[model samples]
Each structure stands twice: as structure tokens, then as C-alpha cells.
Target: MSFRTGKDFEFDPINGTNIIAREIGFKQTTFYNSTLTGTHKIDALGGFTVNWYGSFGILDQYIPLLQRLQYNQYTNLPGSPYLALISNGLSQKSGSVFYSTLSDYLYNAGGDISKSFTLFGQNKR
Candidate 1:
């Protein structure tokens, strides 16, 4: 059995814009994955052997937040501390927050049976 987890953050920004934008945005995400697998062999009649194998896995993705806010450039400039920090919290302005989650699972199973034989002093299966 094995397990793994990860977290990520992004500063996606339109470096330089002439006009038509007054919105601030940020994004964050998290994920986790796990797996389990096993195999077994059994003895059967007449020298025949049987093999069984199976595996299972799962993955989850969570986007905690994709926060966005549009503050007036006329009131607070881009470099101002008010714009840099949530100085006044949310207000009556163009604002949006988006989030999502996803899950995936999979499984595999198989079996095989075979016997050995001798022909003309050579081994055959």
C-alpha cells in the first residue's frame, strides 16, 4: 500500500495591462492519491497452477479557493497597502470566488492457469 499528498498555489496575473481590468485574483489547490495491490498463487489438481492478481487506486483533487475582487483604481491604487491586503474586507464591488472538487477511482483484476508438459525431451506449456 502507498499514499501521497500535495498542495499548490499560483500567482496567475496579467503582468501589464493598459486598461479594461480592475480585478485582483488568487488561486490555491490540494490533492491526494492512494493505491493498494496484491497477488496470490494457488495449487490445483493435475499439476495445474492458478495465479490471481488485483489492484486498486484512488485520487482526489480539491480547489479550496479561487478568490477574486475588483476594487476601484480611483479609490485605491494597485501599489497601495489597502489593495495589497484585505484592509477593509469585502465590500460593494465586483467580486467573485470559485471552488471545485474531483475524485477518481480505479481497479484491476486478472487470473491465469497453465500446465507444463514434456515432449521429445523438451519442456512445453
Candidate 2:
């Protein structure tokens, strides 16, 4: 009639030059089901069934990089104050789901990136 769940994150600062980090977590639940009975057997299935599940994880080292770019002090360029810059990035993600009763499955994936834009009107002339 009741359930519990938990999660946690781990970090290792000694390995991989501390340039990366990893995380993991899990959850579980338990309950009784009265309708889960055999075919054409209502009185035969008089007990309750319990279901539960859980998960866990760990994290690697993480190291952040710092960089600085210098430009002509007098030139107020379009991307001044380092607010705008040419950046090319890509991302992708996929997932799926299934239904036992309907025997249905679904999946999806997509990613894209465009040129960076800056609100030039806000720049001080």
C-alpha cells in the first residue's frame, strides 16, 4: 500500500585529471494488485502480487577550462564585450516507450544549431 524512492550523485576528483564528472540515480515502488489473476480464474487468484524496481550510479572527474581573448581596446566591434562569437555545436537525444496491452512502441531523436545572434541595439555606441 506504500512505496519509497531515493537518488544520489558521486564525484571523483583524483582521476582523469579531474576533467569530467558522472552522476547516477534510481527509484522503486511496491504495491498489491488484485486484478492480476490467471485467465478465467477469479477465485483461484486470491492473493496480492508485489512489484518493485531500483537504479544507481557514479560520476567521473571534472575539470573546467578557462580562456581569454584580447582585441584592440579602441575598436567597438559588433561582438564587443565578448558577448557574441561564432559557435558550432551539435546535440542528439533518443528515447522510446512500449505498451503491453496495445503492443505499441515509439521513439524520437533530433538536434541542430544555428549562427549566434546578438542584440546590437543594446550595444553602446
Candidate 3:
């Protein structure tokens, strides 16, 4: 959800409001030494004002996996993750209005992983 308001104190008043709603669902099934996954996204925006801007978004994901046993057995697992973000901004003036505005954003990410494996003689009997 987001909202913004602005007005010319000498002449009149200006204001606005906005709201949003969303829902998502997912499911998966697997039988083997593999994995399956799915995702969903929803977003909405609406408002009324002078020199006003806003946005909202929602994201959801689901995953299911199955692994085989070394001898005789089975394993089942399921997982899900979700995220949401909202932002709003506005600028206005009155009585010979004169102004300037600016905005900026920055992001960075990094990761690393390592693994090792070993093998034995084949059918050394």
C-alpha cells in the first residue's frame, strides 16, 4: 500500500490514497533423484494526486523434491519462499512553484561454494 498528498496552501488542497491486494499458491510432486519447482508473481498500483507516484509488488515460489535411498527407503520434502516490497514518493509546490528532485538506488550480491567426491574400486571381489 502507498499514499501521497500535496496542495497549494494559498488556493486549494490536494491529497490521494492507494491500496492493493494479491494472493498466490503453488504445488509440485517428484519421484526420483531430481527436483521440481514453480513460481508466481502479482502486482497492482492505483492513486489520485498531483505530482504523485507509487508502486507495490508481491512474489511467491514453491518447490518439491524426492530422493532415492542407497539401499531401500524413500524421502520427501517441500519448501516455499515469499517476498514483498512497496515504495512511494511525491513533490509539489505552490505560489509560483519552482523546485527540483532526484532519486537513486544501488545493489550488489556475491556467493561461492565448493565440493569434493571420491570413488572406490569397481566390484573388487
Question: Scored by Cα lDDT, where does model 2 land?
Answer: 0.24
Candidate scoring better on TM-score of 1 and 2: 1
lDDT tens digits, residue span 9-120, model 2: 2222232111111222232323322222122212233432333333332223222322222112112234334221113332110111112211222333333322222476
- TM-scores, each model vs. reference: 0.43, 0.20, 0.16
Clashing pairs in 2: 18-62, 18-63, 19-62, 19-63, 20-61, 20-62, 22-59, 22-60
For residue 47, model 1's alpha carbon misses the true position, in angstroms, by: 0.7
Task: Estimate the lDDT of model 3.
Answer: 0.25
The order of the candidates by lDDT, greatest first, is 1, 3, 2
* lDDT of each residue in 1-125, candidate 1, tens digit only: 11212211122233322222233333343444444445444455547666667666666667665554432222224553322223354542335455667777777777777787799999886
Residue 77 displacement (Å), model 1:
20
Cα shift from native, residue 52, model 2 (Å): 0.7
User: Which stretches of model 1 miss by more than 4 angstroms?
Assistant: 1-44, 67-98
Which portions of model 3 show Cα errors greater than 4 Å?
Answer: 1-98, 103-105, 114-125
Would you list the C-alpha lDDT of every candidate in the order shown? 0.46, 0.24, 0.25
In model 1, what are the clashing residue pairs, if there are any?
none
